[model samples]
Target: MTDAPLIDPFQRAVNYLRVSVTDRCDFRCVYCMAENMTFLPKKELLTLEELDRVCTNFVELGVEKLRITGGEPLVRRGIMTFFDSMSRHLESGALRELTLTTNGSQLERFADDLWAAGVRRVNISLDTINEAKFAEVTRWGRLPQVLRGIDAAQRVGMRVKINAVALKGFNESELFDLTEWCASRDMDLTWIEVMPMGDLGNEDRLDQYWSLKDLRARLAERYTVTDLSERSGGPARYVRLEETGQKIGFITPLTHNFCESCNRVRLTCTGELFMCLGQEDMYDLRPALRGSSDDTALKEAIRAAIALKPKGHDFDYSRQRPDGQMTRHMSHTGG
Candidate 1:
């Protein structure tokens, strides 16, 4: 009998994988996690070898692109070694692309090495241009450091993208300025709504959830917009500004809900396979991956997990956990 992979019940082809190497970050963002956050223990995290093996298995199952994320993937030790081993797959044509999402706190140190390794693109998360406002948002005073990281990343020949999470009464006033800055530098930029996740995710912040739909309308007022010809195989849709030749994208997960075209899944640092970001259903991949390295069991587990993927995320913000609160942090879920 011939062996062929089974598609999900929804018929969406899963071709992208987001791997969170760690849950510890150098900065504490107000919208992402609790102010006093406790990170995962070292033993609970997957080793570089296990990560490499699981990634190879995903490649065998048709996952072509991989994005490394974290509470700051760079903050995790030995990430460079991890990238080195994975780059061979890209070189051997086993993988098409490898990318990263970072706070840009450490980009100045690792960008050149990461480019030489295999990271084709880098998305730096920056919410504001003002120094004090940046500190207020990320709860850290590292904007200058982050800015240097962005410059270093571009200088290393890596394609750069700026990721901004639009929050009301915060950086919303700087939207026009942020767009102009990215456009002048010829970098692709994206704006996403702040997702309410975890027990730390308070309903009060829901007031800060600015819709990208409204932002798009504001954008159309000043620029001549057109559709982009390329697709990164992820959720964000791109529009090209005819005047500046810069491409801007909007990821409105809370407002527009791109679950209809969702073709991705997330693997947490501890090997939990998440089918939907907004749902609690997950397959503990660590169980199948432990000891002696059974590739067969891992593949079977992966197939089973894929079959059970929900058709879409039921983003009912009112849904509450047993503790009378929601409890999924974006950092733990790989953003």
Candidate 2:
């Protein structure tokens, strides 16, 4: 179908792929989605067999890491079976790691099953630790439920990482307390700067954007910050926490872009390929996936699409409209 999928147009070797399994989410986060919205129909989503084939094609072309995402991956019916199918790739040595990103709404009930299905790493979206504040931020979320889910995931020995969005007016005050709590638990914690992506439901969301640089400066007052020589091979540049097994990282697309070393590609639940998260470039593959069972066809399509990957997002918030603001919302693209 094509040559090795290692090198893209910019000579960046792609080794990571984030696949969105579904677009339906339970929570209505102010930043992710609006309160009233219609989700894609189930018939439009790629079947498990189709996803397996897509993921397999990527693995065949030097992609060693697979992270399954969703509006909330757990809410997708028959997801456990899907994990069982993906687990085979891990067992066969086709994929080096299998991880998930979730809102932690259903983690308590599915954590044990996830471990059995071969997932050892997970990222949970939690913006606040205070119960009342959590409720206000998530619209209808219960902090206890999410915390229980995190506990369940930990009990199963899964590597847990908490992803908290830094909200200027809401969670900034709690950042230190949350960091201390997570560090005490020996869990890796990352704070993502709130971004203005897509036509978010809440018009005032952009107003809530917080700078990760400020957070880092504040933490530097108490803890020793040292750059990690190596990280988990993700976009974040991790720094080891002083005197603790935990690490603190920041994903600052606005302040410090990581696109120069970007190697990640995304596949939406509906079979659309997004070469860059903050760009509007998208290619639909549902026809290729459901048309023929020929694996080579899909591989060729993937290669052709990625060949035109952008060098960087070039996102400047001060501009009239950032490229990311024109792209699909983060949830629609995948978590």
Candidate 3:
């Protein structure tokens, strides 16, 4: 391994990596995927051992934070084995953090194992608290099951953060309610603007484009919102509510592009590395990984991919249409 850090063409040190362990998810979230989704064949996905090798190479190349993502990462069979494998990096202090983004449906069963494997924090996607509305949003998810999962995560001393999509008319009304719920539990909440990803048969991306600018304005009406300089190594910009002492995050990809400070890259289940979320440019690392026992080619492939990282994404919602939309679903790239 080289003694140098992985710096992109723009001089940004790439230290964070998000890897999708599987493209298969239990819930069919309306925004994330089509109602009748076609998942990837199991054979195409990188095995747990292969994922560990790829991630280990990344860490050796100066990657500090590794986040496991998926259609729903916890749903993968023997997923805990991957988490256990990554824990060695955490123990050696080479990796700063090893966490995952989940749908909270499987946390009830795996929360304890996750905590034991050095995962201290988790990002759970919860769009709404209303049982009926939750069902409507997730299409196949039950509120009680997810709530139980959340409880289990918290019970195991894991810090839980809620990630809610800011849907125009769907979740706009529940903003304050969600805020209060998270604040009461001492969990931070982040509101994300819907991105124009894969085509949903009956779901229109244009209609769902809710700007975080407008969402923040609505939040200011109820609480004293003050911007914070803190960044969690992701795209979300944060604010602190003085009234409740709660931290709120806004991920405004369309309204406010975060590509200028991009320090992370996403790896798909099949070994495709996406440098930008909204762009279609990607480099396949599978050939390098599978071609040899030595990681020389794999590391070179990652460096070459990082060199091609674009300055920013082209997600534009100003033309009254979903411009710069990718052909793949958000779930395909690990959401």
Candidate 4:
């Protein structure tokens, strides 16, 4: 076999990996976990050791950024221990950064260890600011706990960013409030357009996705916003506060597709490697992990999966139709 490493068809080098630790979550978010999901079969999940070993090999193959994701990463057992082990590499500079994307339900308990484990950045999913609305969106999850988690995460020295998924009829009015709160903390807030890939996901939600032009216009009427291009890997359009150093981002998945510069890959909790959110193609990494596949072979497999990455998502093409054709839910893929 040729020893040359593989790159995606777009020449995008795969350096970042988002690993889903579990397919289960504490909250039943309308756009993530379905209301009827009881439990995932244990047999399909990868053990902790297996996940770490894969991560180790991935790091050796030029993966520098690692983000722990899940239905809720904190919900996974021994996450702090995992962070402890992963942090050594980060501290040694073998890994450039370690981060987590969570719902912030259990962050208060794990935030300290996570920061000590070399985790410096955290993304918390907060869709609504209203307590009743939060409860309604998450089925029965407590908004206070989520808010407390955010505060705790900030206290632990992690750069906390609130991820708000803007749906048509839900959480739209709270956009300004979320941005203002983030500005006060000197942190960032990202507003992502709702994708039609979860339980509450459908063509209607995708259609209702607010456009970046519209969001910017609304914000401009109140505050003086300056556009910036400092972020290239992220999928959001960047903007900085005129006076404060705070930044805000808007991801327009419905009105615009960002696959041209997308540099991220997602690994499901069940061990499937997905190249794109809209595409169903995936490479099963469980066998490779179980069989002790070498780095060269593993790299090839990952590249093959990326080669299949769609040119772009079909949300804009199906703007009018409710493309109820998503392969996996966001909770399963660690939204």
CA lDDT scores, all candidates in order = 0.84, 0.84, 0.92, 0.77
Local accuracy of candidate 3 as per-residue lDDT tens digits, 1-335: 36368999999899999999999888999889888888888999999999999999999999999999999998899999999999999999999999989999999999999999999999999999999999998989999999999999999999999999988899889989999999999999998899889888878988887888888998999899999999877899999999999999999888887888899999999999999998999999999999999988888988989999989999998889888988899988998
Please give the clash total of every predicted structure, in order: 1, 0, 0, 0
Q: Each candidate's TM vs. the true structure?
A: 0.94, 0.95, 0.98, 0.92
Estimate, for each residue in 206-301, the C-alpha lDDT of model 1 and write its tens digit: 677777878888888988889786766676889988888888988866556678877888999999999888788999888789944668888888
Tell how far residue 78 is off in model 1, in angstroms: 0.8
**What lDDT score goes with residue 137 in model 4?**
85
Model 1, residue 92: distance off in Å is 1.5
Q: Per-residue lDDT for 309 in model 2?
A: 88
Instruction: Give per-residue CA lDDT, model 2, range 1-335, as digits (tens).
Output: 35476678999999999999998888878888777758988999998888888888888998989999988899998889889988888999878999999999999999999999899999999989999999887887899999999999999999889999989889889977898889876788998877767676536645786778888888888788888877566668788767665788898888788888888899999999999887888888777777788877787788877887899886666553444565467788796
Kindly state the number of residue pairs that clash in model 2.
Answer: 0
Deviation in angstroms for 133 in model 2? 1.1
Judged by lDDT relative to the true structure, which candidate is superior, 1 or 3?
A: 3
Better of 2 and 4 by lDDT: 2
Off by over 4 Å in 3: 1-3
Ranking by lDDT: 3, 2, 1, 4
Higher-TM-score candidate of 2 and 3: 3
Looking at model 2, residue 37 earns an lDDT score of 58
Residue ranges of candidate 2 with Cα displaced over 4 Å: 1-3, 243-245, 318-324
Which candidate comes out best when scored by TM-score?
A: 3
